[model samples]
Target: MSKSIKLLAMFGFVAAVAACTSGQTEEEYVVVNPEPISVEPTYTGKYK
Candidate 1:
């Protein structure tokens, strides 16, 4: 009877802790906007 009571107490404590805790983690999302790329001007001539 004494061992059974101790085991019951241990199981209750575990159950209480498990009930209070969130098992899964919350995921955070990050959004990134890419910058626009500009094209360089074409070379007209080597020298003026």
Candidate 2:
């Protein structure tokens, strides 16, 4: 029983540390690169 309590406490401490450190310390920037406005044309016609 004592061992189980100690393990639980240790696990809780590790979880608390992880949660605290993961609080978004830096701002997240979403970089959006737009696709080209015009697409390349393909030739589908027969030439005489």
Candidate 3:
């Protein structure tokens, strides 16, 4: 392979690797549970 072509390929590989690994972090999660809730309906004069 030509020198310049090989160099470009290596640079591309390094750049791709760096981008893939730059933001490595721990995973995040959310836990939810069911709960009872009470609500009142609004009244209008038309209902009466």
Ranked candidates (TM-score, high to low): 2, 3, 1
> Per-prediction TM-score, please?
0.46, 0.52, 0.47
By lDDT, the better pick of 2 and 3 is 2
Off by over 4 Å in 1: 23-48
Report the alpha-carbon TM-score of model 2 versus the true structure: 0.52
| Per-residue lDDT over 1-48 for candidate 2, one digit per residue giving the tens place of the 0 to 100 score | 999999999999999999999896978799999999999978878872
When summed lDDT is taken over every stretch of 10 residues in candidate 2, the lowest stretch is 39-48
lDDT of 3 by residue, 1-48 (tens): 699999999999999999889779658899998675867677867857
Residue pairs whose backbone atoms clash in candidate 3? none
lDDT of each: 0.88, 0.93, 0.87
Which lDDT tens digits does candidate 1 get at residues 1-48? Answer: 999999999999999988777555668899999887987889889985
Report lDDT (Cα) of residue 29, candidate 3: 97
- lDDT at position 5, candidate 3: 98
On a 0 to 1 TM-score scale, where does candidate 1 land against the true structure?
0.46
